[model samples]
Target: MVTRKGEQTKALILEKASKLFNSQGYRASSISDIMHETGLRKGGIYNHFENKEEIMLSAFSFSIDTMSHFFSEAMAGKQGCMERLLSIISVFEGIAERELFPGGCPIMNAAIEADDADLLLQEKVREAMDGLLGMVRNLVQEGIKKGEVKQGVDPEFVATVFISTLEGALALSKLYKNQEYMKRAVHHLRSFLAQNCA
Candidate 1:
């Protein structure tokens, strides 16, 4: 069983670390910075995670879990695989518009910041991204099975486009600090889906 205080501490650390990692990038953020953000000492921080890499891994996990939960919740009452796919896409679009992450999508940020530099981080990013795209691909495949999506549609290709479009929107939004670009990208993406999807 987990103690309430211990769980609280862990949650607090993860929250601060996620935000700091998002804003500062993994290369720039330090354990000390995390400590400062959480108002915890070195010992307190280290007590939960062994090193910065460990914290990074945990933060990545936290982000994936959070996003997955959001998607699941958003699609709870919705029916049809196409609608489900749109709901998933819409949730991410909402996140982009809200600038949910100070750094952008955690997986995307990790891919750009650490994928080439750190193989471990790269693997983590790859796994997380693959998992998300896999969800989309499965949804699309289900739609095809139900005769909802276009016949002969390549689920993987569709998933890739969806992922790419969202990531591109995020990059643009962060660059311009404007949701308009993201909104437009999302609009175009949705239009493409509506036009192409059967």
Candidate 2:
């Protein structure tokens, strides 16, 4: 059985590993990197996780949870589908401005790195993406029910466009080392929503 102290140590390792993996990418971050960040020896890490893959899985969960909390906080006072959806973009823009995760969105980073490799990591990314898509879809559906959004709008299509646009914009922003890409994407998204949503 793992002791309370052991659980604390494991959580610490996961927290540090999440940041390191997000900044360095999964394959680029080695055990030594995690050890250096967490100040734990190999034995300590191994005592909690069976391997690096195990650590990575936990770290990804940590990253996703953190991102979810950030979005929730951003959406707290916002109402309606348009407001909630725009809040997501606003949060992403804030993340870019503040360098919240160092490298960028953890899910996007992991998805790009794990594509065509690391099936397990890829699956985790897919689940995270699905969760995000579902959130957007639910918001849109709620808006339709409340008469806040256009009755004919397809929640699935809107969610897809919103997510894909943001992801693509984030990638370009990171690639070009400029926030304008994200800002422009947000502007276009807002315009699209204004035209489509009520």
Candidate 3:
């Protein structure tokens, strides 16, 4: 029973920590920052996590789960592959507009920071990215099967282009503090989807 309660507390800490990490880069966020955000003492935090890295791993998982939930929610009730894909783009636009994570895409954030620095975290980021790309590829393939997309269209190539385009747009949007970049990307992507996928 005590262990169960401890697990719950740890989960709560992870949730809070994930938001902080997403909002502020990992290196910029410290244990003290997590403690402050969670209203837990350092000892309380340490009691749940072995160290900052452990907390970060858990937090990254939490962030990914949160993003997945958002994607699922946005895709719900949308019919066909193109609609579903556009729904994802809409979700990204919403995230940028509302600062849903307050620091743009969590996967991108961690990937940029963890590249060649932390093997474990980098692996986790790579896995998350792979899953995302797989989702896009699967959607494109499904569309082809349903005769919604061009039959000869290469799903892997489409997925890669789609992911890279959005990531680039997101980076530029965040860097320029302008939503127009994301908007234009979405528009162009929609056009591509209609022309090639639809």
Candidate 4:
């Protein structure tokens, strides 16, 4: 019974922690802040998580799950691979332009801020990126089969370009706190896709 309760507490911590990290960033959000937000004592927090890094990992996983669900749903009911690809872009463009995260893309934000100094965070970021790239790669391969994308077009290459542009757009938008940069980035991405597909 106690063990189950402990697990429940840990899960609760992760849910709240993920939201806090997403909104305030990993650096700006402290354990004390989490404690305050969850109304859980420090002892209660430390009982489950060893440190902030562990919480961060949990938050990242949470973000991945959330993001994957959104993309997967968007991909559903789409016929051509190219259509699925466009839908993916549409999701990102809508989210980015609308300020979905209020802190921007959590994975991109974490990658830029924590990649160099934090190895664990970097690994999580890499995993998150691979997840994103995998979606694009799968769609591109499908497009090739349907003659939507060019035959010689490399799925991996296209995925990489797509991921890079989206991340760059998020970074630039965050830096200037301006949505125009993100809009321009997505426009360029759409143009690139059009050129490749045509």
Clashes of each: 0, 0, 0, 0
List TM-scores for all candidates, in order: 0.92, 0.94, 0.95, 0.86
Global lDDT scores for all candidate models: 0.84, 0.89, 0.89, 0.82
- Candidate 3 pairs with clashing backbones: none
lDDT of 2 by residue, 115-182 (tens): 66688999999999999999999998998999888879999998999988888888888888888988
Candidate with more favorable, higher lDDT: 1 or 3: 3
Instruction: Please identify model 3 stretches exceeding 4 Å from their true place.
Output: 1-4
The parts of candidate 4 lying over 4 Å away from their true place are: 1-8
Better of 3 and 4 by lDDT: 3
Off by over 4 Å in 1: none
Give the root-mean-square deviation of each candidate in angstroms.
1.7, 1.4, 1.4, 2.4
Q: Write the per-residue lDDT of candidate 3 for residues 20-78, one digit (tens) a residue.
A: 98878898999889989989999999997899999999999999998999999989999
The candidate with the higher TM-score, 3 or 4, is 3
lDDT of 1 by residue, 103-140 (tens): 67888888888756688888988999999899989988
